[model samples]
Target: MCVAAVSTVQPVLAQTASPAASADKVDQLIKLLDDPEIRALLNKQTAAPAAEADTSMSATEFSALGHRIRDHLRKIGEAIPQVSSEFMRAGGTIADDINGHGPLGVFGLFLTMVLIGLGAEWLFHRIASRSRMHAALAQTDGARQNPLHSAGRHLFAVLAPLVAFSLASLGLFMAMTWPPLLDAIMLPLLLGVIACRFVIRIARLVLIGPRTGKDVAATAGLVPIDRASAVFWYKRIFWFACVFFAGWALVGVMVALSIEPGVRATVGYALGLGMLLVAIETVWNRPAAIARPHGRGAMEWALTFYLCLLWGLWVAGLVIILWLGIYALILPGLLKATTAMARNAFGGTPDVPGSGNPVVEVLVERGARAIIITLAVLWLAFLINKRSSMFTGEAMTDRIIQGVLAGAIILLVADILWQIAKAVINRTLEHAQVSTADSAHAARNGRLLTLLPILRTMLAIVIALIAVMMVLSGLGVQVAPLIAGAGIFGVAIGFGSQTLVKDVISGVFYMMDDAFRVGEYIQSGSYKGTVESFSIRSVKLRHHRGPVFTVPFGTLGAIENMSRDWVIDKFTISVGYDTDINKVRKMVKGVGAALLEDEELGPLIIETLKMKGVEQFGDYGIDLSFAMMTKPGYQTTIRRRAYMMIREAFTQNGVVFASPTVQVAGGDSSSAAAAASTVKTAMDLKKLAESGEGA
Candidate 1:
């Protein structure tokens, strides 16, 4: 009737709006009345019609559907009175309908069921204990090994008792065929038990995690808490909360079963107060599992942030106590299964130590999590669609769901990409470690390792930016303004941090040019040390005396690598003029040849030492210079060893070292004594020189 009325109005309005209602306008308006699409559009613009036509169902079919629904409802309405009279007759008693037995029979049945369930659980536990499956779970952490299998172990550990209880509850349900006991006691007990099991298992998992390793078992456990505190919280606060929440749910079931409103309200208030207490206790015993980042005033900030986050999580936990009754019981097992699948698909054992591909591992783990979370969200959305009336006719709900799904995909893709980049970089560094003794090869490896951190940072930034943009797009947000803002921000940062930019760019160029590799001893002005590592803006050089100098690439000038290529050392040796010059030269040459033949120093020496005879004629002696080419950083040791050998050879050959003498005129006994003293002084000097040389 409403659709007909609206259809009548649109044509009249369209005709009246035109000054002249031509034949064309009349025809168009008449066409609109017959067109279902036009009527549907009009219905959307106006109020919805009382009875909208179902194009799929004919008039006769729609009538049949309505009749069936009315008939079913009529049957229910008719049965309600009958059920009420029977309920009144029973008067909520625990009496059996068949024998008129009271509470004793019901209690006996309950006890029997409990024993049966307990017996079954015990038998199963024993079998599991002896099984190889249990041994596998005991040995491996199972995260990277077999996620599904590990998850199964956890699920079995947590859910086995619950499953047994459920079976027992089912038996009790069947045995208590008497309506009164079934309605009043059996139903409430069953709900309470199930709710309690879920709460307890989820709480235990959250507080201490699955029995994997002490550390891994605490992965999802309360952070920053000691074992004692964890035990205390579990026993004192969490257990209480679980029991309270379960009992509260039982009362809610009672309320649903027509319990007194006053009693229900009282129980609700009590539950609320108990939950508040639990939240307070949780805050008081905040876990110390997470560490604060190092910085000035960081601890305070971390504390504040974690406290707020913890409190919020607590509040959320309370709010979802009933909801968890749905998910907490099932999602964990499913998550484990999905994780196992991912591990099987993407995980592998590395062929060598440190060879495991982190990319594949991260991608597998994160991808599995994302997939599980996405599926879980979608599943939840589907449940909400079926159970909730809020989104039944709302078009915006669909848009929101789409937006959420889009954002998830964008984030997932970004995460996978980031993981891939990191894996590539890590794999490169791993391969680079196999470099040989060749300088170029080692330098290449060093440069590759040095570039990893910077590349990771760049990749992260790019991936994050893309992810943000894609997520915004998914959410129907305009990206143009954001892009413009980002550009402006970049310019501002570029200008404000010019020195940082310059340093980073200089470092980048230095890496590209392969100026100096890590571990090479290089000198830049006065500061010379071994290259320990490289950062985005600076290089760390460890000095010989254990000081680390962080030199910015921009500040470096004229780099001299002392550890590269060959080094030539030249030094002069002074000898007595009366000494055999050819013998001394032959001796020096022999020293170099002997050094080249030496097993320890042979590899370091590039060329034999050669003499430039009689480099200079000093007043005390004739100076001869010799030079030898050796590997970089080996020159000092080679020079020292060569000189020592030469001095020893000279001493054995009786070669005299040069010494200064003073002349004295001989005329009297005093003059003769002075000349004797001068001669004795020369002899003493020669002895002193020999002693110093030997020492």
Candidate 2:
């Protein structure tokens, strides 16, 4: 609408009473030729429009037609003198006619000036006045900057949108009636005033942020460029406004240049985009100044300016890409450095002795390494971009070359990091000097060994299955069909593997319950040995004599961990039953008393150890059972030491150790005597046989 209206601006420019404005707007030359000097200027620029040629004519025909016309004209005695008059009448020969010199021309020019240009000017002045006035009121006085004043100011600003709404009816009426050039700006303008209330809101959150709203603006360094930002906020608003304005302007230009419209648009857009990119790069990567231009603004202002600049936005995208690239480059090296730094900072790995503050040290090393890698990667990527742009030629070939160069840089950097990581891991392994890995890894290996075969089977199965799925998916099999097939297959598998599943479930519980742990001697399923490995399907044991046995968990229905809880130990002394049993009890009590006072055993023993009494009375000796509660796994050592102490104490008391014995005695009858005795007692023998069921 605007450019179509340019015919309107042209007349307004030509007829303008002000000489200076007309001088600057030379397109108003028809009206401007009212000035005799400008008329001469228009005459010098005059040129004839080309004559129309017939569409059906070929080049030769057209040339022949043109020759025939010239010959006819010559026959009619045609010359420049007569042609000049016709051209003059047609308003091409004379300069005064160029700016439309007729009285009707003057009326048309004046009318257009009033309709569009003058009308737009009037609205411009009107809105500009209102904008200025609104800003003035917002900045009334700096005296009331305290909380109470701030509160009051905020309350008033909140009410301002309502006030603007009331005046909007009048503004809208004027807009509807006059239909000004910028009716589009009115709604956005009103909404913006309401938004100012939000800026004031920042002042209330002083706990975590700055106190003054001006501080935010100061941080943005927007104040010097705009004293009225508190009221106007024009900087942010104008960008949005201009974008719509440019869009409207673009449409107008496209309409005017419609003959070759695509070419025009493509060229304009490419050039515009290129310039924007150049501008963004220039400012975004610019070195920070030694000091602020005037030291009157916060750092945020500089950053915001950089952010808003064209180059800054363009490079900001590059920054993220560069950062990711660098991370891919340097992150592996940094992670390796982190692990090494962890060992150094903590004195060793967490499981190793003297590895102090392992948790904290490990975290700091890893976190710091991650951050450092990230920053280095970003910096390196930026360096590459700058160097490539500067050193490379400006050609399509240059872009490809730069891409190759960047890929090479990333690959080379990543390869170096990989080498370093390998070195670090190797060094760590070397220091341990184990035929196998050290205790930490031994524990891990023990865990993995327990799972390896089962995991190996599971992984192989899963990989094969996934490959099948991939092949199906590659053929464009729908997920629904695959999932449905999986569901059915799972049902079939569940039915087929029921016993195995049951074994796995039971095994998991047994292992988790500490029914048996690896390296602990245990008896389960009539098989007794030290536990070698425990898996979902099976349990493994290395027996005392050196045979390894694998038992399915389903068969391991019962378990007894001899190594768990405490051991009930008994030692015998000959003649102990007759030799003052009460004194013997007191002597064992003394032993228990001494053990209770020991520092290490004191905490481990939940209850005091005691001799329960002589459990068996025999002809030669009495057997005693000593009972004690000991820490799990430590019970074996505790029981051994306690038994040793009992033996030493009993021997000192002259108590001789006793052993169990058996004696054979002669019966009432031997071979012949038994036969005579049985003959006399045949009835008794028969009764005996009957009692034995005829045996």
Candidate 3:
């Protein structure tokens, strides 16, 4: 039996190297670079010797020397072997043997892969069951009815054999003889896994009813859509990919049989191409959460339809065009349709007929563009698969597809990696407040919480850039010009906005230093307000006068913060010196008791408003100060409320008002009345009840 075509580069993996050769190679390179001949060739004199001669060689001579050196290097390069590749090649014989035969080889591979898959499922499920799921399953009222639990099992059952079949194909190819009893064994296993999947899918569907299914589906905005369905379809697509790969392997064996002879070998290339097409379709076909439901289902349906129609039309067109001698030219229409679908998938905004909703358009656009690129890939795959002896487009399409696939893979891998990183960051944040007792403090974390987003963003940008460079390199595209262009643009922007950039950078420092925080009442030059918003460049403060003052971090020179922690408002209602200090203190304490008794808003106050004796010795009476730690943003309200209450309580206690009159050098009532009337007329509006008609 033949092994399915295993990884061609597995033995020569680009990432790995052998220990013996790796060390020896490094030493040899270092030794060679330091050798007299090599050193003289590489060395450059800062200044030429006074009697320097023209030592330039003739072009022909240089060319001959270059040719000799290259030939030697090529021989050396051919001698090197990798550790991973050595093992991979050791097993490649199974695939080579299977390729020597027929369908029987394929069957052998299928069984082997199925067994491997089952082993993996058992291993992971054991881990999950041991950790958290076991306890959860026990507590649920209807554990058997829990669809989530059922879905997990269904996935494992279906994936086990699919995986086993692929691996078995590899093993049979490596270990078994050519064209052995592989297909005969594998077809049954393939059918068996498909049957298992069919059963599992139906079971999950049965658990989905009108009421219950709606709830599971409703968690979409936060998680994946059609959770069970997506899981089921993802598994199906993976199996289909395996099946396609296997079919290609069988063709490879047939081609091998006639390899020595002049049998045209286009079928293996075509099937390999088809495998790539199915793989692309499989990746983009995934269901995602539709946070904005408007046009979401339609977009998904369009994506699905595009895949099916393109696949069907390509097959049909290829057959017709070959028989009828025509290209059919359906590509433009397909391209247009895909472009529209891409735009819709990634570019739609939520249909909220209002402003200030959370914008999710960026995600949509990103998703849509990704889908379109995938669509173009499948299209190219079709073209490559259909190319004939005349002007075969395989080479060009293969390069393009390689680049596209690399980019898509990078995006996906980056997404998964970012999620893992975010989880780590969140866990670290949680660890900080694990022992905090206050409800708010228990939630507060280190400065890392703020830095986490920045770090993630920086990492994603860096990884994405690396991915882009790699994709370009894979497609043989030069990246030097692009890098140079970017550097130029960065320099230009840096030079143009030097001051604005400085302000932004300085603001970041301001935030990091905690110069000021939200909800603090502060007075700056021309701005006495409470902090409402803070950002990298500026902060917004709302004033009591009904305006928002925007202050740049660079411009805020000094500030007076009255309410950073606790504020004590001093109150002085003068009483005659004869008034008992103990009595007045007792009266104030009683007022505090009455306030504490008011259960309606008692929690808002940290402690009852209390009196401190003689905040200052006033001219006519004792000045007293009162204070309490009220909730933040309640200073003005509490101050106003306390003032009114104190006035009423003082009236009840007969506390006198302080007069700034020197019993004013004898009582002159008429002069005093005239003076008071003049002051009222000049500066204040007088509102009076009409005379009672006594006249």
Candidate 4:
């Protein structure tokens, strides 16, 4: 049986072996395995039942985890003492380099190089000082006159010195030669200092603006934070940067000394703890001038707890969970804060619409957010790859990480596009708000304002749907079915809610026809009012009185826009039949002339008030027609003023308005007198009754 088994396996083993292995070697291995002793051992192994794999968690595993944790803690405690030794070793190496190179030690040499770089920076600044000062002056002068221009000038003024400093320092650092150990230690240290300075300067420029001995309120800084909050953040950021860079430098030195990973991690954690404390302090003690939400105390406590939890996770080496927390909680807030800060800096006032340079604001805000999200995604990818062993397999892990990153990128791009679209739409709407007296321009602007809002809403919905589908696709989700399902659902909705569809379609056509606009007075059926605003399917009409009507476009059939280009208003007045007709025409003509020359109403009057003709013969007098053409919305006011002027002119010329009169004529004088007396008494009684009712 053993011989047969060996013969069966030999060919397979030979095929699997290296080509260098000869047929004789393979035969020899099979012959050895075919021996009685090896055969008995293999038979014993094969006869025994294999131990069932224990997949469930047991007490033994728990105990093992506890032991590992204890060991890790012990290692951390032991690693503390090694830090001093590592520093000593690095210092001794530096000493050896100094001793070999001349009396000026490596530290001193680094300082001298830094000083030279500073000298170069100073020289550059000196030569450019006049220009920078002029730029500052220009910025101050044009800050309100032209905010975008002033912002550009301020940026140039702030960046020029820093750019010069960076170029000089980096150039000089590259020109020098140093020992390998010194190079590693000093280069990062020098770069860290330069970077630290640059950050501080930038923070200063943003929070405090150009240093012209002005108060924070008077400064031209981009941020809209108060003086106390600005100073507080500025100081805190400076300290935070110092702590971070110092930790980084220390880690670099430790790495150069070949310190154990455990020791380095412990030291790094300690530095991180310090930074965490600083952050906590800043959070709790931030200037009260900064706005806070309701339940401020609870929010602070929650944030503090979250920070502590994050620190604990880092210390426990739960990098994946730590990063998840950062991304979920911290990243959104950072993005929002960055965007708001950018807007406040660029946007002149919160109340003013389209106050900022949209291009610059969007670029800075969206670009910064994009960079932040990209860096975060890349970092998470790196962490996942580093710990890929914890997952199922590298290939599957890579696919998942790629999917998540791709989804993130898609969302980021969508966000940028949406923000740009919003900016353009909002800018258009802002420009559409014209406060002009020109009827044509006013009407055009009103129409633009009315349509743009609804268009903006539709655009937002479309963009959002597209963005959601794209994001899902990036995450490896099949979107074809989703689209089809959405189409079917929309059809169902259209069938079920035909009224809504009718309203929306009607609104579109109404806007297309330019039937009525915002601020125009219109009437359709009984729904009549000035157009206050518009929504997707409805229009808000503010009545001339106090009432407001929200009428849907479908119901507003055949709109009569009263406040259009011009209105020709006609009114009738009854005059005494005995009055001279030519004299009355002459008086009306003079009244029209006076109206045309009136300061307040002249501009509104297209054609002054004039008597068209005698409208008709009335019961007691001749009714004369007067007509005037005036700008829309001002016809009533001008007409009222014209009435007052005509009344005064008639009074001065002895022209009397017609009134009801009774004339009794009869062959018998006594009978006629009795009829007249009866008529007079009846009219007097009617006047008395009306007076009593009024009182």
Q: Write the per-residue lDDT of candidate 2 for residues 1-695, one digit (tens) a residue.
A: 98889978998888885566455467675567698887777665553222223342334564654564455344334333343344344333112433434434433533443344335444554555565466447767654333334434444543444345434432443455321222222333333332433343332221112223344443222122223322333333333334434444444433432323333333334344544444344334333322346543455455445434533322222333444453554468446645553444333444654433434443455445645654564565466556443332345445554444444444434434443444344344343333352445654444444444454455556555655554444344566776898899989998999999888888777656646655667887669888876666888888889999898888888888775545554444444455667767777788777777879776666655687777787755877666777655565666666777777887888766665333325564366576666555876777788989955
**What are the lDDT scores of the predictions, listed in order?**
0.68, 0.51, 0.54, 0.79
Clash count per candidate: 7, 7, 40, 1
Estimate, for each residue in 1-695, the C-alpha lDDT of model 1 and write its tens digit.
99999999999998889886589989999998889998888878665443454442345564664565466445544554454454444444434342565556655755666566667667766666666456656667645545445556666777876686677665656675555534455566555656666677765654555554445644444223456655665675555656575666557455535644444444454465565465445444544433324433554455445544543433332222234343554468556654554554445554555634567667766776677767766765665555443232345566566677668777877877887788778778777878586877876787777777678888898899889988887777889999999899999999999988999898878887778877778999978899888878999999999999999888886788887678889999888888999998888888888998999999889997888778899988988888999988889999999889988999999997777755566558788787878788888999999999999
Best candidate, TM-score:
4
Which lDDT tens digits does candidate 4 get at residues 1-695?
A: 99999999999998889468699999999999989999999888876644322343333555655565577677888888887886666666666765464324666766776777778778886897788677657656645655556667667666676677666766677777756776776667677777787778788877767665345457755676677777888898899899988888778767765778888889889999888888888778876513665425876678789989998877776687789997998788678868876777665566775666776678778988999999999998888888764444446457767887877877788778778877787787778784887767777788788887887788778878888887777666899999899899999999999988999999989988899888888999998899998888899998889799999888988889998778999999999999887898999999999888989988889998888898999988999999999988898898888899889989999998998887766688888888889988988999999999999
Which lDDT tens digits does candidate 3 get at residues 1-695?
A: 13433455666664477645678789999999889987776664523442243233233455654565465444434434332353345245445655554344555556566666556556654555554455445647664333334435445544544455435434444555434434333444555454544544443333231122235553221112345654555465456656654554444444333331112123333454565466446545544433454525666555456555544433333332332221233335334533443333333244732221112222333344445555654555555455532232356755775666566656655554554565455556446535553535432433344445456666767777987787787677889988999999989998998877877887778666755555567787887787776655677899978899998867776767765444554455666666777877787787777767767546556777777766766866666667767655565676677777777877888876565433324488887777777756644432332333333
Per-residue error for 599 in candidate 2, Å, reads 4.6
Which model is ahead, 1 or 4, in terms of lDDT? 4
> Model 3 TM-score?
0.48
TM-score winner between candidates 1 and 4? 4
Task: Give the Å error, residue 518, model 3.
Answer: 4.4
Provide the TM-score for each candidate, comma-separated.
0.54, 0.32, 0.48, 0.78
Predicted structure 3: lDDT: 0.54
Off by over 4 Å in 4: 1-74, 84-106, 130-179, 210-221, 226-228, 280-285, 289-308, 323-341, 349-356, 388-409, 665-695
Candidate 1 pairs with clashing backbones: 148-340, 223-287, 223-289, 224-287, 224-288, 224-289, 225-288
Which of candidates 2 and 3 is the stronger one according to TM-score? 3
Q: Pick the candidate with the highest lDDT.
A: 4
